[model samples]
Target chain A: MTDAPKAAPATNSRAGTKKELSEHFKTYKHVWVFIECEYGVIHPVSLELLGEARKLADKRGVSLAGVILGSDANLIAAAATVCFEHGADLVYTVTDPTLAHYRNEAFTKGMTDVVNTYKPEILLLGATTLGRDLAGSVATTLLTGLTADSTALAIDDEGSLAATRPTFGGSLLCTIMTLNYRPQMATVRPRVFGMPPREPGRRGEIIAHPLNLAEDDIVTKVLQFVADRDSNQSQLAYADIVVAGGLGLRSAENFELVKALASVLGAEYGGSRPLVQKGWITADRQIGQTGKTIRPKLYIAAGISGAIQHRVGVEGADTIVAINTDPNAQIFEFAHLGIVADAIKLLPALTEAFRKRLSVNRLAS
Target chain B: MHIVVCLKQVPDSAQIRVHPVTNTIMRQGVPTIINPYDLFALEEAMRLRDLIGGEVTVLTMGPPMAEDSLRKALTFGADRAVLLTDRFFAGSDTLATSFALASALTKIGQEFGVPSIVFTGKQTIDGDTAQVGPGIAKRLGLNQLTYVARIVELDRDANKIIVERRAEGGVQVLETRLPVLITMLEGVNEIRRGSLESAYRAASAKIVTWNAAAAGITDLTKCGLKGSPTIVKKVFAPTPRAEKAHQVPTDGLAPEALADAVIAEIFSRQPSVESDLVRFSAGQ
Candidate 1:
């Protein structure tokens, strides 16, 4: 599908006019979360973002809204209802065939248009593939500020959005501000925010906007949507318990120790980005800024030096236990519990211990 | 089918050290090299150019000293080199960085035929954001392909390309139309050394230099700090843990004894570890 329309005169008043800037900023109200959906399924990160947005909305004393863009009317309506149950006061729905698959051109155009038409002071998005792709483009188009992979979000004393994210490979945390920009934008990594209790039967106002752009004007074509093979998919983000290895594991062969522990815990397995760089593991098993974000109940990190990039990806774990020979490793700084030992040796021990404890518990039950 | 590979000069992160007293990275005198990941992308571009009998151009956006990395790209078989340098571009994060690069790419596209394929390393080790590639793809309207492990197939005549994309849990085999931007994953291919002739050419090749104005960027507001979305308010070192490693003494002990002692200390400190080992052994 292609979308063709004469480029609408950019309604973004903040682009050039100086006299109207103050009025435009004051007129903007409410906090909006862009619900990212793919293949007709709403991503969990979208819900996580809505939960975060609700908090921001509460703090700002403004209504929280969820914006859904897709072709399926029913799906958009359902997502809007879910958003309300999760804490949104209102939901804006934009449905069109062109909006079905996420083509950067159409999706960005659609979402940015909605943002410009109905101004929101704060806009939040999940740091998923689709969200990241769309956020960068939309921010650039609107000439607005956007912070990516933020771990924390709050309104500063000056009433500006303060986005805090780990930087310099997770060695430190830096708070960024999009001052003098309308609709302050930020994308938070999945699992970083706690899931809000869903109020089932809760509902909110649904406002539908017509998609004006025709399919022909869109330059990029979606030849086909190839869903990832089920067998090859890594469910690391959703694992209840996870065991990940790092360079401290010493070699690729040592990664088996990580897998061994993961198997015992019935958890997913992964490693730091360096392990993938070292060919010790595949890219899919990478857990860091550029990799998968995990929020397991318990996370065991073996021989990992927790760089900021890797730290952002795994900081959401309810409990983090680090096993590294270097007691000075960065991973220990944030870990709930730590063992200063070689992962190669300690991993097998931990795996065996967990196996025995679980078995004994099973027998007792 | 001229190809352009954009590479960055980054500090060797493995050798990077934080000064104990200053707590600042000891970047001075640390040899800067072409970003390791970029080498894989450069090699892939060279391979494509070799098979198609075309030229590969290398471009970089950095300080004047970054010419070294561009020359290095030339030695890897890039036929043309361009260095975009200016004080105005300093302190430029990925957003401003991409603006300069996109300008340079547009200029190159004007001089040479528009590149069919633009290559960049999966990400710079320093930033580790992996957003620049996608940013460039968005600006240029090229099909974006990040974390490409292998080029599964290519059809030059049909202008179609298929690649194995690295996703969260597995590889995604995807087919896309060109011209596309491909960010090559590390370990996919080993870089080739420059031959004697290539080395000489690289050393002598005149690298085209451009500034913001020279590259046709008229919007001063969208060039550097003003254009960037995210701003770094501060940079500090991570706080160290309160406790250091508790060591196990093994003075005058045999190999087995030392192992046993270490194991004993571990179990004593973390008693659950002992039972875990016993259970693991039983399972096996």
Candidate 2:
């Protein structure tokens, strides 16, 4: 089917839209976050978003609402409770069987329908795979603006959502404002904002809505879901200690040096984004803006130049040690400790040394 | 079946240096290459073309210089290249970009055949938004399959397409129909090197150039910054941390001794790490 021709502006200029658009959107109030729920589990990024959304909602003197779409009633209710405990003032839920799986069709329709009904001034979603999939379509359906992978979000002085994100491969930061769009949308990566403390027994108003979507209408069918097995575990995000390699590792074989250190220290091993693109590591083990955002207690980098993209993902570490031959490597700027040496040679020695220290400590104990 | 793959010319980020004084990106001397992610999409499109009896058309929306990227795609055996360039498209955000590109695709469909599938990278390194693909899909009323790791099955006669999409903690094997927009995941496939014949063909191939109006974009206000709802209010570099890392002198020491000194320093700074390391070893 061909797209129907879109209606053009009557005034025929950019200046003609803002005043009319803002007035048109005057009724759009409150900040709403789409609580990402699939199967029976609610994504942690949804809770984190509610925390950030609460701040934006409070800044605008409006209610914080969390929109959850799921097939199960108990799961939706449970997620709504968690949302309320975190920060949401109310919850909007659309329960339907088609919503059980994250199909772009069902979720987008469910989210957009609720959004159109409630008229939220600002909407937020986690920048997870599912969130990105739904946000792109929803924003397009609503003909609004969406800033993806925002590192920081705030309410501008004029009461607009100012979303700041890394651009130009994370070398630069830009603040984007949807000046004329109601329900200004943006997606934030996991752990970009701190999770708020949950208040036990906190209750909120729950508003229920019908999905009005049938299984037949959805084009994409989920044939199966192969959950990541233990053998393929790459829990880099939650690891207490993380050891990562970079392009400086030279070859995939050299990357084993990084894995050796991590194995010795009982740490999770990962590499930079390029290593993933270069097939040295899986996408899950990539440490950068586009990959996993890690918050480790101790992070050790070998031969990583630590670009801004990689820096944002690891800045939350309690302690970071950077090992590279170049003293001027960007990783040194934020790292707690710096060692100027070739990771290839130093990694094996470091692994041996760490193993000996651990064994010695074990003997003493 | 006609397939259109979107390519972008992005600065080689490794060579991108920020001006120390102004903290602005130094564009000079930095080479431009086809977005690395787009290569996967182009390769996937070409593979489909090779499997089925069809042609792969590479499309891009950028400055006139973007023709270089289009030429590069042609070297990969694309049947045609279309460069959608216009002064009005400058400073366009994702929304505006999708508008222009979707319009161009429409024109392409009218001129060529309707594309069975439209392919794009999961995200551009420069924009990194990954929104434009879905935006185009929505505008064109096409089903979108994003973050697709593999095209498991394709039956053109049945108009069925099944793909493995990488989702949270799992792989969702999804089945959809034709007339879809797909954003191919990186590292799934390697881009093939161009043959000598393909290289010669690319060097002489004429890139189809279209202005906004020529691409049937009548909305002047919707072509560029004017059409973009999101405005970039500020551009700045991330602030460097106040405290630089404490240097561990590796002057004359071997790797082993240096490792020992590093361990001591870490333990001295954070006494808790020593206890934690012991616990880790004990658990192992």
Please name the candidate that would achieve the greatest TM-score relative to the true structure: 2
lDDT of 1 by residue, B115-223 (tens): 9889998767766555677667778878877777888778889898888776433456667778998888888888998899999988898988888777777776665
Model 2 misplacement above 4 A: A1-21, A230-234
Question: Which whole-number lDDT from 0 to 100 does residue A67 have in model 1?
Answer: 94
| Stretch of 10 with least lDDT, candidate 2 chain A | A1-10
Candidate 2 residue lDDT tens string, A143-165: 88888888889997778888887
TM-score computed on alpha carbons, candidate 2: 0.94
Model 1 spans with C-alpha error above 4 angstroms? A1-22, A230-234, A360-365, B19-23, B141-178, B184-188, B238-284
Q: Can you write out model 1's per-residue Cα lDDT over A34-65, one digit (the tens) per residue? A: 98876666778888888888888888899999
- Supply candidate 2's per-residue lDDT for B4: 98
Distance from true position, residue B21, model 1, in Å?
Answer: 5.6
lDDT, model 1, position B178: 87
iRMSD, model 2, in Å: 6.9
